[model samples]
Target: MGDFKVLRLVTQGELSWEVETRYQQCYQLTRKTCKKIKDRVTVFQAPGGFLFDIFEIAEVKHWPDTDVSEFTSITEYVDKTLSGYFFDQELKSALKEKADFFTFGVDVFDVNNDKCFSHVELVATYDTKLGKVSCWTGKSYPTEDQKRDFINCPSLETHCQRLNGIRVLVLGCHDLNMFSPRSRASIAPGTSKEIVINQMQKLCDQFKPQVVLQHPHATDSANIWNAGWAGVRKFLPEVKTYSSAIHYFNTFGGEPRQPLTTVLNRTATRDVQNIVFTCFEDGGIDLV
Candidate 1:
């Protein structure tokens, strides 16, 4: 178990009904490829963090079609999505069978449609030593209710204690969008580099992570790419960073507009050897 290595899977592109099958195929292919290279994998684990999982459930419920002007009828979307039509039973079973740890992202909005808070949740981790799954939910941005719940939540307290030696942080594509000047407009207005830096500072202060993973899909220019890295380093100085260039494969005509290899290699200096780059073809850079 100690010999396991970390395998980070960075997915690109938006979710759609047309490419849903292909997306699942790609995920399975990636998992199989990783397994062939090395088994006994654990995702986010030290030395080797490769594990197999199935399905990503992202759904929004009770969202107003137009401006509702009230925060009423808000429901747990995950439960509804899981129970609704088109939900993949096989995939859900596979996830339950394969996933030992689960990470969730939460965004809270007010009646005015403004994002009041955003947080990441780590929950229900498997303990190989204990030979059972331990239940927990660790939240990054805790609300007053969450804080009250945490006080009475033994599992959450245990999870926090278990994270003492862990020092890795994972960022989603939306998180990476903050670094791209062109893409920043696609996100919330007034979202600037400073806002992103402040968020990173909050996370850094809470986690004190030694390694940061940045997963962005498409970067049009070298300047944009470097700016993304600079944004991360500015908040978390001297931290080792790992990023995936998965967008190269998703480009129109399945061809990159620019030579991704050239860009990655040029940026990979000895001084920044820790800032490793990877792609879908290569699976990922081995952390071990």
Candidate 2:
């Protein structure tokens, strides 16, 4: 909890099985990321679609790395990753038997401050209904025709976490974009746009977090899809909003977006920080 440095995995266009036959991707990727990361991640930020379609990796599961200065914690998934359409029975069965699953994620606020996982408090992101995209077919479909992809949120919430004595703001891709009416209709139909934006303001004003992380798979993730964090900047003018996204030209298909890694600063201008990683390289970035 002393150093504020963090290692980010941009998780380029290699979301699916790089092996092409066996889905041995996440662990291999994590191991490679571990090699380059020179900082411990008591609290981490996972880019959207890091492994599965969309998930938040708030804290690393294994800690007590041999050297905190060169944090080398790696991850492996072991649960049934996916059980829905777009996946056949054979593929699902193979994944459940051989692949690993993330077992350490809860909501950011649900973590126990009194408890520590190997001398480090664990912070997790509780997937809530606040800004969850519904039955995403990548396009609209009739309500009845749509299947129940997921349902029944324990609660609706937007939150930031306190980790290693640092106030960190974690925004899902749609969470920040909730300011738009169209986003409301798709992401959280029952809510209003103004309420969404105001909630972010409340968190920023109350916590005065120095760092922010937003992960998405969109092309313009560096600019937050062209709608920058302008609405909330006045309150958090000094905060550095960092972001990581899948590389442009991923299998999802998109044009090249440079400065693939960037941070949105006080004045709401993007401070282009192009950080790149090949399958063999190892390095890290400081949060300070």
Residue-level lDDT of model 2, residues 129-216, one tens digit each, is 2111111111011122112221111111223555445776655444445333344345444333344355556656777876655444
Clash-forming residue pairs, model 1: 4-48, 5-48, 5-49, 6-48, 6-49, 7-49, 41-50, 42-49, 42-50
Identify the runs in model 1 with alpha carbons over 4 angstroms from their true place: 1-20, 39-164, 177-196, 219-223, 250-254, 263-288
Q: Evaluated with TM-score, which candidate comes out highest?
A: 2
Q: Which residue pairs in candidate 2 have backbone atoms (N, alpha carbon, C) closer than 3 angstroms, thus clashing?
A: 36-282, 36-283, 77-100, 77-101, 78-100, 78-101, 79-101, 106-125, 106-126, 107-126
Question: What TM-score should be assigned to candidate 2?
Answer: 0.49
